[model samples]
Target: MSFRAPHDGELLKSEYALRGFLPKADPLTAFPCGSPYAPLDEIGRDLPSLLYDKGFRSYARGLRLPPWQTRVSVETLPLLRLYYVRIGFLASAYVNQVGEEPVETLPGNIAAPLIDVAQRLRRPPILSYDGYALYNWKRFRKDGPIALGNIDTIQNFVHMYDERWFILVHVEIESIAAEILAAIANVKRKLAQDANADLNRELWRIEGAVRRQVETLKRIPEHMDPKLYYKTFRPYIRFFDGVAYEGADTAPMQFRGETGAQSSIMPMLVAFMKIAHRRSILTDHLDDMRAYMPAEHRTLIKEVAALPDIGAPAYREVFNAILDAMASFRRVHYGWAEDYINRRTDDPRGTGGTPYMRWLQQLLTETEARRL
Candidate 1:
């Protein structure tokens, strides 16, 4: 299937449905008023540059709450709202100032509402130890002297939040997807193992469809330049910053965190491939193994258990296929990197900042070598 934009509401609903957690789809009569929660734009605006670069906006998109669960998410919404606010405030404060300051003191008054909202929502407040703060803050502070003056504060904020938030969001979404996929797969396995062959066929069909959707998601585009967006709002789009002193032959390059909701899908892709492979191998020989299998079969089961974690040969082939699919999907959907390289004169300094550039380069190089 061609890549198309995902409906966030629908995605969330599917997620909840798959998990058997269908939430009430009641209309939110009125959104809570005068709450400490900040507007989405405000949170976006206030995010640190480094964090922004890593693709917090993309991460939010990946959050795609099901429409039916919006009311249910109300409990977590305030917390979600506050979490971004704290990120925004910290981004604004730290960006405007050049030095490292305590997270508690950085935002001063603005932080009050954020803290209050977090408490009310039971969401943890953004802190120095959180992945966002730990990875990028020190580097941002160290590089304070040379960043672009107009966007220094924003850059630092985006970078700091990008890595920490990307990891957190990626892990959560992938974990949820993996659980649902595994459950569906398990049901199919049990049905196949049973004497009721008709029921097994029905379950297998449902499992197949779910598997296709999961594969479709792996091909979805998650990375894009924010500048290409139609809206006036521009959050951090670049995943890195390049600094070239007047006489230096090569610019210093720093990796910012990923951007966009789809970027978080990578871990899910990896997990799904692992699960799918194990399921395939297990179900393929399950009937045979049940009757005359030796004690060595126990070792095989143990080996399969370790595949997803340690990436055994079977899992490796499955993962490679998935990666190949992703690469082909990207090239077909977004055009090859040769176009980009030609346009940018193969300048790493400029293209390196783009999240998609690295992947594009890799794909193009592989394609070229094969032709040669």
Candidate 2:
């Protein structure tokens, strides 16, 4: 098998080619510029300014209710909004690539000029939601969403091939997760004002969304054949090494450590599961791990930590939903790791090969079997 290195033009095309996905511009109507949210390509250039604009600030502050609402909203909601756009762009590329009757590299005519701006700024693109703050930026937004667009999809297919399959899964979970957080915050404010407020209705809304997103995973096994993921996409993931070519190179190096979404996202989900059990497990490696999560997410974890234990039924529904999502994510990666990473690779650490992957599968399997 042969792989071509990522070229600059391909990167830009993947991120900015939004014309078809976006509605055509109509200049005569009110707000005739078209939906601000449409033509998602422009967001890479526009989102940072929008976040700092005074009007956006006012819109963010307007969401704060009950005066006692956690200040986390100032950062969390807006950042999550930004993530929705990124996920949509990545998903569009992924669905179009894989869903094509004949799967092929995005044709050259369609793949150039994709958004590779982050590499020019000397930072990785903010593809996964967890580590946006770490990237180099032209203008800082202070725990706000990074303005980088991830054109990794435009690179050699390996960088994201199978991972894209799971990322759409992750994106859905995070997308709906933003809604769940909003509902929970709303319920908290309502309860603060009136102790007898019917929070069940609000909580049930979150539970239903979570359950539905989890069910969406049933489609994964159909699109992602294990052999395909192992042979095609799995080889593209990198651990460390920051090559200078960056976007033009498929295996650009990393400065920190490995940050495959599979691992980075686990700690956040685990934090929620721990909250359901009324256990706090911060101040260690777990705390270090969560630092990659957005400030809003970190703040929400702290807020959940503060709630008094109301017994299982009080939060059981949401807890189960989160747990189900976490377990399902683990299940897919576990299968991938076992089938590929653990199969024939020799141990570089000298203990054994892929021990952590085996341990993770065992742990997740055991956790999923537990009753709430």
Candidate 3:
């Protein structure tokens, strides 16, 4: 029962002070995208209950392993719930964004100001500490059955802390989605031009559809102050296993939990691209991610993939751009790793043990080799 003592707690406070952890509004006030089953804000209400009920029910009916295993599964439900909130919010946001405009209408000239403002928004590096995940939030509740029993509890649980990290992650999601949509639009435009037409009706339709989605990102709440998030909330968001580990003491620590790697939008985009191309390498990883998405968003993505003339000659170039995006994302996060993990821990494990990091490198390498 020995914890890391005053050092970890003191360090957390100091770091929070140093980083300027001030949130202007509640992070839950930040929107979730639209869902058919629920409103945009409450889109993922049923997830926790669904997962818990299904998981134990399935275990009961089928693979009855060990009692401890079942307990482990129950214990892990909160983590799954938290993950769903983070990612489901993104999917819901995207869905709501798509709903802002009808696909039948042409994507009008998006104002320069909108694009400029979004472009100017700073993208922060992914920070990792061993403590954020360590605190079992479920235990913090009074009537704690170690499960997110209802939507109200789920709502309260997520907003219990400053969720600036999730907000930042949402920013990345929108930015990356916008980039991909732009690339798709460019491809569509080129295809239209090649067909000896003044205006490609299909291209306009595609542009309108993608543009609506991209513009929705612009509506993501601006409540998160970057300085505040990094300084205050980020430090406390650790990966300590609660009882056994209390997390690090000093500034800049290695990332805890696989979520630091898994929940990243770039990796998910890369996964989607691979799946579209029928690449089986990361199917399991993608499947795990799929659980985080709203059902409609998944259907929307499928429709995007099936768009006519998407796999044209321009597909290679667009695909290469996507690969580049994934590489660039890795580079940024790697820089954080270098500063936090490598420099602090003195372990040169950048892109070494992390499967997602290695996957990005391998994918890039294979892509370049194919070009050669």
- The number of the candidate with the highest lDDT is 2
For residues 1-372, write the lDDT of model 1, one tens digit per residue.
111121122222344334321112211212246434334334444444424243433343333221112332556643343343344334333322223221213222343433444344343222221222111211134423211121111113333432233223322333233334344344334433542323233223433433443444343234322222211112222222332212223344233322321222322333333333223322332222222211222222332233223223433443344445444544543442333233444444221134345544443344333210
A best-first ranking of the candidates according to their lDDT comes to: 2, 1, 3
TM-score for all models, in order of appearance: 0.35, 0.46, 0.35
Clashes of 1: 28
In lDDT terms, how accurate is model 2?
Answer: 0.37
For all predictions, the C-alpha RMSD in Å is 17.3, 17.7, 22.0
The true-versus-predicted C-alpha distance at residue 269 of model 3, in Å, is 4.7
Q: How accurate is candidate 1 locally (lDDT)?
A: 0.32
Each candidate: what lDDT?
0.32, 0.37, 0.31
Error of 1 at 46 (Å): 12
lDDT of 3 by residue, 335-364 (tens): 444433344443323211234544445544
Clashes of each: 28, 13, 12
Task: Looking at model 2, report the run of 10 residues with the lowest lDDT sum.
Answer: 20-29
